[model samples]
Target: MKNVTSLASGAVTALVLSLGLAGGAAAEDFEWPRLLVIGTPGTSSGSFASTNGWGPILQKETGTTVRIVPEDSETQRYRRLTDREDIAISSVSASEMRYQIQGIDGYSQTKPVAQRILWHHNDTPWGYVVAGDSPVKSVQDIKNGGVRITQGVFSPPMVSAVTVGLPAMLGMSEDEVAEKIEFVPASSYAENCRSVVEGKSDIAYCSPISSVLSEMEGAPGSIRWLDLDPSDKEGWNAYLAERPMLIPAEIEMGVKTARGVNGATSNFVYSVPATADVDFAYNMAKWFHESFDAYKGTHPLATRMSMDQFRKYLNRTPLPVHEGTVKYLREIGQWSDEDDTWNNKAIETMDAWIAARQEALKAAQEQGIEVNFENQEFLDLMKEKTAGVENFQSRL
Candidate 1:
């Protein structure tokens, strides 16, 4: 009986050990990370269908469990992600990232937040869109003394305000350039297009390559995009020098308008993703940058994702290259030691400028020097200076 009891105890111990080993093996074999994706919601008329957007593509590529949550507005998206640090977000603007990082604007007044940006995808150009029947032809046409322009409420307004400053820098006023231009606060791009089609608005600003433009193009006579000339290449290049991720992109024929209107491609800023985490961001960037061909069957636009274009875009925004991205670039011989030295210098210069500006602003405020204008100027300078930095930091 003693021997029998001892044998039973040994059997139970062995069984338990076997079960634990099997569980460990199963755990080691599991290879998916729980990923959360947040972005602007898709529209029925737009090309951002759930199956076609970056979210699905990312999941397919990474073999990770992805949960895509769409927000009604960019502000809301930012709020949710910032408020809940555990949730990861994508499709954030560089400016938004800056605001969050520096605690500027509403974020500054509300709460301090820090975020890691993974990678930049594209530099989205803000387009000035009009109905196909409108007499407005070019950006100069809008500036010809009394043209009424309509800018959408959110992202468009911010960009238009900056562009307004650009014209001011060139010796023009909002009234002089856009005499009757009024801002129409629409809920969505679809609503903006509808307003234009109904003649309730003249021109609405949006991205030329965005799903909204695609929908408007199909609407026939309802919407047409005005081309911003690359003639301001010097100014644009200066902007690009500061913002490396922004490339001089030409809207190809058939993408937006019919042939013969311009006969030549129109130039604009293209958006790209950025990240701070060198390894993760670079890995994400490298995967998308190299495996773009894999998504050709998914979207025709994917064909444009070429290595040459990637290099061009990178040249436009030379922020601290995410380490992972750098590793890939170095492997492909696209980067060199010289590039590293230049990037480090650029970073140092930017940091010094930011510190000096901040100190000056503080001193001016303490002296009661009516620093409102100075504050505004400082903010604008920061906007232009750190556009690429915020994006790079987000990935980290």
Candidate 2:
């Protein structure tokens, strides 16, 4: 009887061990799709240090393995998207995406990426910076010339948009202004800041009220921010309309001081978060909109993330709303049938505008009028005026 009992115990132990091993094998066999996140290097330390900015949070929310692919430059980040990567996050402006999808620029090597833009988020602001002791006080002051502003370190798209595209919208050519100011390229934030302090550059172009901007605040009264001229409201507004991210923002001194100038009011920077994929963009939009508190808890910049802000900034642009996001917005009654009608009409109008521009270009070419692709302003005005007509047609 003792031998028989010992044999039974041994059998039970072996059975338990076998079941445990089988269970472990089954668990190991279950695979999850790896999420790839692409980001620009050196901008967000928090993002890099912590798993690609949203990787950790997303992984915790969804039971998937998140991987962050950090690229050394913005161009590299966008170029990587050509591969069959699962997800990528990079600083692609709305205009850049539009041009890429249309194959307007040199991005012809890559096919148009079929992904949903999840959500557009705010970036740090871009504004003119000057020496604290300098007599220049406003965007207008620099317009008269004698002031040299440095772009510092910016992505190719950013450079194109700001220097070429933005000035083009204002009916002024960046090249025309080239003789008036010096354009110095500083690629890194540290290098740009050092240039300003060392007097190698006069005004530095950067975002307003960023951690980097805050660091420059300690520049011992050597540098100050220039306000956009209120008189140039038309130009500014036109630029803002074209670039939805360029919202009106004030730089308060006490709230955030720059170079010891505590409470000055200036329209310095506008933050915008942009994406290329519409469905994912929609999901991201809804997620961020609904989970505002969660995001704000992660970063203070998220304070501007709101439904109203989305309607105000996003709806005005030529970019298409992610279908998923559109669905969410409609379900929440944030968007109406009229809004849909308007969007459809707007799209049709854009198509018409592009067609018209092509026709005009052909006509001009027949007449031997030199078509300057380098002049971005002319192209923008053509698009803007066309979009306006489309808006009117939609209303009818």
Candidate 3:
């Protein structure tokens, strides 16, 4: 009887161990991607340059190969993300994404879009630049002047705001701004900087770290960084009021290089969308977190990134956080009760916003009318459409 009992006990133990191994294998499973394409700017772009290192590291660590694909504008990347055309992730300016979602300014003609955010890397800042010899020293210097600023044709709305939002900050109407400001269109930041160098542009809008800015600052023009000084209360307040996305960021001040003068400018973070396969997203986040140390060594800008750096920007996230990322955050006890409340409220709000948007679209379609957000009737119609939606008040 004792021998028989021993045999039975050993069999049970073996079965339990086998089951545990199977569970572990499932947890460690990586979904082999057909293709993973990351949307980026041109090879020379600061945004895209970071990806050159990231692609190899991602492939090695996650067992998923990542392809670096260049795109000129956020709107262009938006199409791929919306279509889910093997585009696993892309880096876009958070401010521009917010602007696009609200369908404001140059983007007013397009319908509002909804996307998810995964991680926000804060390595880039945007602001106005000009020849150091130019007399345009401040925001006040541009008003009532014949200054032509080149707002890049393919520039993210965040970068382009310096030219347009400046007028709004100074309490001028859109028409007044249009009348006073001459906007020159260019194809790239490189061209925009050249405009400033060749005297075609008075002040240039640029990402401080771009090669174009560096090139001009080095050769074509020794540039001075222009910003709304914090000490100038009226100017600072007005700038903030006009451009909600402009946060006080410490930008690299350089005479075509790092001059070591700390200046305030607009900065943005790159994010991932929610439509990404949850398992893939979950594994991606987990892989990134586990390999955080190794990944940073991949590029110069990445040296600034950490797991906390990824989650810390959730406050300003214009869209919903990915479920996979949320899972990783929850596991680490990083996501809090406050986060839960906010996320729940946010999700409810977004759902109502989309549903109401669809309802309004249907009304317009049936009536064969255009739903202009600026029209009073459109506001009234939207109010009527969303009035019954749950948590509609919270969205307000």
Candidate 4:
């Protein structure tokens, strides 16, 4: 990756130096939409708030009326983008794409959506959190048994983190982790953290920016995030075994509650379907890069949307990047040969999974079995059949 100014320092400098850049910028040859819609998580979500913060700036700068839609369900948002293509782009995580592509878990009956990545916007550095008064100080302390870990019932990403990702981080199997930790059900992401505050669950995974953390911090029990020593290569290796998309970037400017903890971050991007117009993707990326000075202060997370941070995590995304965005990245000398190799491999893997989903659906029909995530027989059949395909495993 090319060396560039960090967002923390560069954002403020750009604000002072290039205050007039967006206003005086020349119009591009590519056409701009009068109205642009961006799909994101519910209004209560940080991602949604982030868009709301910067959406207006984008609209004012580009003369596009940016409309933001909030959907609480990731699968619903994924379906909207893939099946309907009503929204210009939908904010999604790498792990969510992994499940959607494989048609696993909540995506059991659905076909793999053909979405391509646009850019790495910002990263959320989060970890398993506990009440300040709880006995758990580090991740190691959770293995003592009798501890309750919040298992998000509605959110598959949260469920995967607690059930699979967290355990792998500790070098333990899901079965082994289950034996030690009591899994408490949580209805949503907010409820997961609220459970910790309410004392219904001892621990829950969360980020400092989450609005619920204030409640957790002010609660009688207080809030404490379990440490995951960054220098421990063995521990991280195990964690990446299950979640390769997660980055160990430090949370230097995180909320007061997150200070002095190991920083493990996951980048969320605004992705579009493969069939999206090439010029649309190209312009969206180019606009964000050029208008950094105008939108950096619109939201705290918006500052991280700079080209520097985008390139830092560009090579880490597991999804197939859109060709239009690739054109921009290549023009800027950010896309390397290694990136092309990784991107091609990811595209091949995605195509294989899409084909496997079709085969799985056909086999289920022939066997007179209902296709459902809850149906263990159908799940097993999918696993058995797709096991031979190259890069067939789910990253979540």
Per-candidate TM vs. native? 0.56, 0.57, 0.63, 0.74
Alpha-carbon deviation at 95 in model 2, angstroms: 4.7
- Which stretches of candidate 4 lie above 4 Å from their native place? 1-27, 129-167, 172-204, 215-225, 231-233, 240-245, 362-381, 390-396
Q: Higher TM-score: candidate 2 or 3?
A: 3
Tens digits of per-residue lDDT, candidate 1, 1-396, equal: 000000012233311110111211232243334443334333441223422445577777677544544454645555554543323444454554544445455442223333433344333455456788988776556455455545446555434543463354235665555553455566666676566666777766555555656677767675676654556665454433233233344545344463223212111111122222334444555666666666645654444445665565455443444455567678779888877785565455435444544554565457554444335654554455445433332110
Q: Is candidate 1 or candidate 4 better by lDDT?
A: 4
lDDT, model 3, position 172: 67
Which 10-residue window of candidate 3 scores lowest in summed lDDT? 1-10
**1-396: candidate 2 lDDT, tens digit per residue:** 000001012233311110111111222242323342444444454334333445566667556445554555534445555443322454354444544444344443333343323355443345556667767776556557676656645566445544653455446666667756566677876666556666777766555555566666667774676655434556655555444334443443221434233111211111112233333434445556776655555654444445765665444444445555677788688878867775565455445544655554555457554455455554553444334443211010
lDDT of 4 by residue, 54-170 (tens): 899888877767778888899888876777555667888776776777776889788666678887767888887888888878888777777889998997767877887777777
Model 2 ranges with Cα > 4 A deviation? 1-85, 88-96, 104-106, 113-116, 151-197, 209-212, 229-233, 237-255, 258-285, 300-309, 336-342, 345-396
The clash numbers for all candidates, in the given order, read 32, 23, 1, 0
Candidate 2 residue-wise lDDT at 342: 59
- Candidate 4's displacement at residue 282, Å, is 1.5
Backbone clashes (count) for model 4: 0
Best by lDDT: 4
Local distance difference test scores for all models: 0.47, 0.47, 0.60, 0.74
Q: Model 3 clash pairs?
A: 254-259
Q: Residue 46 of model 2: what lDDT?
A: 35
Model 3 misplaced regions, further than 4 Å:
1-49, 65-80, 83-85, 99-114, 121-123, 133-137, 140-163, 170-202, 219-221, 229-247, 252-280, 297-305, 308-312, 330-349, 364-396
